[model samples]
Target: MRTILYLMILGLGMSCSNTSKKNDGIEMDSEIKDTVTTESLSTSRMEADLKKKGYQTFSYKAGDTTYLMQQYYMVFLKSGPERSQDSTEAAELQKQHLAHLTRLYEEGYTSLTGPMGDDGDLRGIVVFNTATQKEADSLANLDPMVKAGRLVVEVHPWWVAKGGKLK
Candidate 1:
C-alpha cells in the first residue's frame, strides 16, 4: 500500500536522524549490527567508569520493608535581633549551644551540621538522622540558643537516597 510505504520512509528518516557521532569524531554506520556492537562496548565502558568511581557490585536483604528509617530531618535556624536575654547572656547561651551540638554529633544524632558563612537572618542548618520531624524538633529545642529565644528553628522532613549518606 502507498500509506505503508510512506510510513516506512518516515521510519527510515527518523532512524537516520538518530545516527550520532562518537567521541573519536567518527560517524558510525546506521545499521542494527553496528548498534549492537556499540551497546556491548558501552556496557564494558560503563563498568570501567563505575570502577574508577570506587563503586562495587554487591547486594543485601534486610527482610524488612520499612522506609521510615531512611527518612532524615533538617532544622533551618533563623537569626533574630529580638532576644529575651542580653548580648553577654546570649553569647553564653550560644557557647552552651555549640557544646550541645558537639555532643549530639558525637552521639550520631546529627550528621551534617554547620553555620552559614554570611551574617544574614537565616543563620544555619542542622541535618538530623532522626526518624520523625517531631523527634528532630525536640532535639533542636534542647539547644540553649533556642531556649533563650536567640535563634528560632523551622523543622522540615527531608527525604534523600539511602546510599547518599556522608557518614
Candidate 2:
C-alpha cells in the first residue's frame, strides 16, 4: 500500500509545477522571475545560476523549442509510529506544522504542499525547491508534526520542466 501510494505521489509530483493561473480569458505569464535579481534571466544565465546554487539541471531542444528540466525533492508525509499524542497536543502540532510549511513557501524552499484526501498512512505531500536531498530532508524534519513523531517524511528526487503547468 505504501509503495503504491508513493508511486502515485511521485507521478503527481513530477507533473506539478509553479504555474500561473489564467485570469478570465487572459493568459498570465507562467515564468516566475527571481525576486533577488529583480529581472528576467536568459536561459544560459538561469542555468548558470541554478548550477551556482548546487541545483541539478539540464536543457534539451524539442524541435523548435527548448525545455529546461530541474531536479526537485518530493517529500511524502506519512503517519509516524508515535501517534499517541493527546488531542490538544496534536492540534498544536498541526498548527505549528502549517506555520512551518508557510514559512518554507515564503522562503522559496517549498513549491507545493497539501494534505491527502484519503484517510491513509500517506498523510500529505510537500515538494521542495531545494538543491539537495539532504537540505530538503532537513527542512522537512523541522516540521513540528515530524518532530513530535506524528508524521515522518520519505523524500525522492523528482524532475520537472521549468515553468511547466498543469493543463
By TM-score, who's the top model here? Answer: 2
Model 2: per-residue lDDT, tens digit, 62-126? 64355778999999999999999999999999899999999999999999899999999999999
Please provide, for model 1 over 1-167, each residue's C-alpha lDDT reduced to its tens digit, 9 standing for 90 to 100: 99999999999998888767789775646575576556556555654564464433222234322111245788999875457687888778888999999998999789889999998888899998775678789999898888777888899877654446465
- C-alpha RMSD between model 2 and the true structure: 15.4
lDDT of 1: 0.73
lDDT of candidates 1 onward, in order: 0.73, 0.87
Per-candidate TM vs. native?
0.55, 0.75
Runs in model 1 deviating more than 4 A are: 1-69, 165-167
Taking all chains together, the TM-score of candidate 2 against the true structure is: 0.75
For every candidate, C-alpha RMSD to the true structure in Å: 15.0, 15.4
Residue 91's lDDT within candidate 1 is: 78
